[model samples]
Target: MDTRPRRRRWPIVAAGVAAFTASAAIFSQIAFAATLFSDNFEDGDLGGWSKSGGTWAVVSDGSKALNQSNSGSENAREFAGDTGWTNYTVSARVKPTSLPGNGLAGLLARAKSSTTFYRLALVPGGVQLQAVNSGSVTVLGQVSRTVSTGTWYTLSLTVSGSTISGAVDGASVGSGSSSVASSGRIGVQTAYAAASFDDVTVSDTAGPAPTTTGPTPTKSPTPTKSPTPTPTSGGGGSTPTGSWPSSTGSVSVSGTIKVSGSLDGGMKRYCCIGDGSQSESQDPMFELADGATLKNVIIGSPAGDGVHCLGRCTIQNVWWEDVGEDAATFLGTSGGDSYVIGGGARSASDKVFQHNGNGTVHISGFYASDIGKLYRGCGNCTNHYERHVTVDNVLLNKAKYVVGINTNWGDTATLTRVVVQSSSGIHVCAEYTGVAKGSEPKYLGDGMGDGHCNFTSSDITYK
Candidate 1:
């Protein structure tokens, strides 16, 4: 889904080690501790590091360094070292290649997991010191600083006791406290950005004292400020009103909200978390039970896997300002019907709607722009469910394909009135031969129109 698209232990450090020599006790001997681990990438291998999302490789940026090239990846992390690493200083040279809108890149430390850690990220808010727990970010401290592209900067993060502090190029990034992540691993990360990292090193130490800087003012991007969903005229045939929604307020969703009956967001914006990044294991923002309904909600940035229709559900007039992983996924197999009516999604690096469940996903009056595929039937679900999708009167802007179906799995995609530009180079219907799990689906072709495609030449109107 190009979708474009850590540290080691040391001895002698007196702080945050479970078992060590007599002098290697706890925080008592931090001053005596020296360098424990270091990596420059000249060896051209990510040996001890574990990666999550993003296309990473060893490249020469001045000298040999590790680079993460997938700018669009969310929360791309490369972790190394021991998980029991507590009270340590992790430092590295970071140079961002790109930072799209809300993108961020930098070093990490005390990472309890790929999702939780203390980081010194170069982001829109400048260099930040924050505690990220399961993707729920809490800014412990921040300092307004310039983060120009292609400029190599020295970033350092240290975690000791409850204090988590960071710095960039020797200037203090401020500090914060977090008891939740008292001890963990060390690593590097990027969110919707690409960066090269080198000269990574760790020692038993803590950062400087927290600076006295006040919280810097920041602004959130308004990417999907429109898509005012009109009431569905005929269940799923309401046109998107181009007017973006002005949020009444915002709610940071740390965990998935289970909807057993129905819940209305009252025009509120909810978002920015999933357990991890673009992986299949990401938690959805909202998880609907069998026969549930979610409506009038605006999904904000870093939307974790969007919504999940577990059985059969109705997603009506919902607008996704920024999609994560995918806008929404229909977990099939109940043979129950799911309806996506009168909503719009934008900035979906992958499919806007994923049909992995059995039954049919009836999508109408929906609008998707800046997307890879508007609707995709699971090509290798392993369950071999016959997923079907019907997209009608959907406006696809700057899309790669309107719908992609796996014909071998008896998947069907019926698209009608798909509005797009003639020269957009967008595919109408792409057919693929489904494969078993762990294999990529073979591309059969595009627009065969046969039974699986089920569309005519005039079905798509070139505006």
Candidate 2:
């Protein structure tokens, strides 16, 4: 039963452009460091800070710290000291007493107003950096790091020129860039969470001026453009004798290859591996060798997996359309790191990601839609092992999974800032032990799907 929907290419392409080029404008500016404002919250009141939207107060015992007690839809913030500073650093000691329904607490720097700012959030599953401009939100980076409630942690966020960076405790989490709102106020922020803060400080940094760099023109082999995949024909035209696999094709690779053009499958299906079905070819258009790095390529509709990557590989800035099975498959000899960044795979009757072996996979700025399963760990939980998968800042639409968690095998699945719409969502298997934030129907109940598996503790949110 193939339950995936047929999706168009334009929307996916547009999203790919936005996803990959998000930091293009901001990354050009260089940054330096300086001190701005520091608040220890020694007073027992919210005196110099401006409150917006949620209930906020300052608590005092032997020490003083700011607190917010709202667990509702409205977010809470307290702006203090500066509103004209840009390219600054904000740091604080914070503790979250309660996190309700994907709640978050963190620092808000370069805030334009109550609704607009650069946010670096610390949640139950991980850390996220986002840019909110004129009420529109854009997630810049998401790093998976499990944080517990009622624990004090130091969070520091720096915006130097166009670069935005964050750190927790002492180690760096992740960094992202945006030039949307250049200058604004510094504040503390929380969403759907009740938290307390102390020793808040803000610093203005000296940064380099922004500059634009143009591309250098050079002659190269022109890549092929394959036709979109359709139900009737396998893909578009047939593969020419000298292209791709053939030595004469525009794509020639010994180890790593970056294709600037699209690939045509020639409507041919190579029958080998697929999702439960063997009649359909499971072979990818290009079977990547181990240690290969493939980037900047558009994979046309293939009969099987679009690119079968073995061992450690890096796939970046690639768009996939009209695939028969998973868009990309990561198989490890033992285990390794497979990275999928800044691209999307759509319109598959099978899963978007097929993990058949044990490995660590990082997928970020990735868009997946219209697939039977968003992620397929082990087929049978007791049979094979599961891989460590971290999905960050991903947008999933019209996708469903039969067993969302470790169906039969390996380990943790950490999902952050994932937006799900009109989808069956994921099944929470007993073996899965991670969190899914900003996504609904995150777990399976007693009588749902293949029946529920019992577990001691689960942070999964079910509706």
Candidate 3:
């Protein structure tokens, strides 16, 4: 059952043609230090900042307003240039008026798109850190540091490695961390609320920031199955070699091989082998090659699990559609890092598509529907020793059960800048020593629940 709704890409408009190329150059001049990246909202030229097409309106205050009222947008600031900063800090001063339905204002870091990135916003109610992986956006942390509506408030956001910390009015409000493999562009954002931004800046907080070298593009590996010879038997002649037959194929794998096809037709038997235990055994159509970095691949199937992994793999810009069960299932028998980056899975059942063995699982920019369990660790399964699983910029549209993180057997998992719109059951659950406890997860905007999870012990801001 395809649970994914047809998504409409929001059109963005660049306000003024004032390209602040000097902003990046200024930052680089200061040893790539922090530098302002705005049009100063002084001149009518809003630099390159844009709005979500006409979703928001821009107005100027005729009177002497903060940062020259004639400059800032009326409602919200939209996406802009791709300021490539791997590890840096972004801060802005915003004066928010009446709280919009989705009131928000802040700096957007590692922004691949308007819907996928890390956002640090300050509302009339509080401050929040959110990430949008795929279509799902998760609120990693939030604090009740209320800001007076229509008043100017300085918001500072810092991102180093996988951790993002935020402060309001120079006071540390909320902070959290997650695993982000790649660096993305930056921008500012506002919902359906009027806000004014001033002194927007981006700079390296730690040592020298990495240069904005374009992303290294990788090719999708050609999928190959195990070369098991077919035998002529009573079932149905000889089973096809390399390809699994839906009627009478047996499942067996000797090693691992790159996968590139779908088993739309039901398969009775399937197996694939690679070099020295890099093996993958699955009964589904798609199989991710071990240690293969995949980019821009689509997995389409009919009411079945997408890919079941028996080894480690790295996937990026991948999409799974119409999966009966989970999209991608991982059984870490070999014990290595398995990653899923920038993709969504639409499933009929619980979207518990990706499971982890003892290996680490890092998911960024992922969206799913009815996610039963994002990452499930087997009982006492530590072949690779699962350390940390980070999910960044993940959004769950409709989850009847647990939405965020659900680990059965004790495995450390981190949900950063994540958002869940509507959920019918708990948000997060973890089972350690046969005892599961954590915040009672609920629908969107609900505060954190009390439980026996590490999140409760930490200083996590919830709205």
Candidate 4:
């Protein structure tokens, strides 16, 4: 009896291989090393690539390319190449055909697995660089740039030592660093977005360094300081006050802290936080590291995600209003436990909770309104147990979608005493039905066990 769980085998179709190699007849100006892996998708198949999530197919018509139209959290990666290389560059031509409200399509490098990788995401209005270790996502760098949908752009990331630099087209965007995992696989990923990738190339060879005139200082966005978190009477450690640019402000303590006043932000949403040495226009209001507890705090008028929870975090009795995006976004690795209890939110510009990576999320007594989805899963995923979601005594008012389990495959979600008073009723699996659009469909049936959602409630109302 093999007690090991059986992995599902996906169908791989053969595609036609093209015949256009680099002809020696054309003299090269720059001497480059041997290509590590190159796929034009002319073969019309994902012959050597393995997918962690999403339904991918080699589209042969019009032009040969690897297409991922499946919604939810899906990433297709190639695992045969060298995962131990120290210095290498991964490049791809990406085109986002369609995007969801908060969709992201990007390339992955140094992927130790599906969940741990250095990702360069092309978001709706900007680009983001994230370092995901196991399930913890650290925003290495982020910058806002106008990205036109349905347009193809060439993107690349070069990792040499601790520094990871990203470029789009031919211009430099930003860079971030991570001392975690050094090397892994390279791949493509999308969340609630339809995208096609072509001319995928990975080269360990070094390219000629461009001529630099001088040290051109990268301009930071318009600075808007966050309100100081006032320390109440109870907590032991001194509350960290003063205005910091981003959520990189560190806080370490054992007890709870109260944010007595509202921290207000502007309308411009930032893509990524600079390395914290520079001022930022839009960033998470508070950056909570591992083992932090925040209580009775209010975040207002945030242009980006409100709180970024890294490790085991408990946020209770918190409220958010006029938030630009997710009120609280959790990105924890190391099997961290994230809890949001006894909170109320209103006038949310987007969803209330954006839970990603690998963590056990317990959300209860949260009343959110004028928002999108109340809960979403695995915006960025890992091979580890995606996220164990538990929702109890939650009320959603006039939200677009209720709950979404957007794991790679067979995500587990549990709901009890969850009520919704919206025109769309209670959406059990909104990611599959809405993003997948029935092409390669996923659904919620039965209860919670292998591709099913466990939902038990009778108080849901719609008018």
CA lDDT, every model vs. true structure? 0.74, 0.57, 0.49, 0.59
**Candidate 4 residue pairs in clash (backbone atoms < 3 Å):** 15-43, 16-43, 115-382, 142-272
Residue lDDT tens for model 2, 14-129? 57547757676886454433345666666455666766546777787236678888766345777775555776678888888887657889888877645557877887787667
In order of TM-score, best first, we have 1, 4, 2, 3
What digit string (tens of lDDT, one per residue) describes model 1 on residues 1-463?
Answer: 1110033444653354434455444455345345767888877788988665578899978788899898866557787777667777888999999987789998888766455567788986487777764344677667786788999999888777887777777777767657767776678888889999998988776444334344532532112122112334433346654456677888878788899888888878987786435677778889999888898788887778889988878898789987778899998465646888877888877888998877778888887778898888888876666567778887777889888887644456767777884327787889887778889989878954444576788888887
lDDT of each residue in 6-116, candidate 3, tens digit only:
212222223321354447555645543434243344443544654432133334544222231222322233555443556667766778665654566667787653344
What's the TM for model 1? 0.49
Query: In candidate 1, where is summed lDDT lowest over 10 consecutive residues?
Result: 220-229
TM-score of 4: 0.45
After superposing candidate 3 on the true structure, give the runs of residues whose Cα lies further than 4 Å from its correct spot: 1-36, 50-58, 62-77, 100-102, 208-463
Model 2 lDDT at residue 413: 56
Q: Candidate 1 regions off by >4 Å?
A: 1-237
lDDT of model 4 at position 87: 60
Tell me how far the alpha carbon of residue 420 in candidate 4 is from the true structure, in angstroms, after superposition: 46
Instruction: Give residue 461's lDDT in candidate 1 (0 to 100).
Output: 83
- Give the lDDT of residue 263 in candidate 2: 37
Winner of 1 and 3 under TM-score: 1
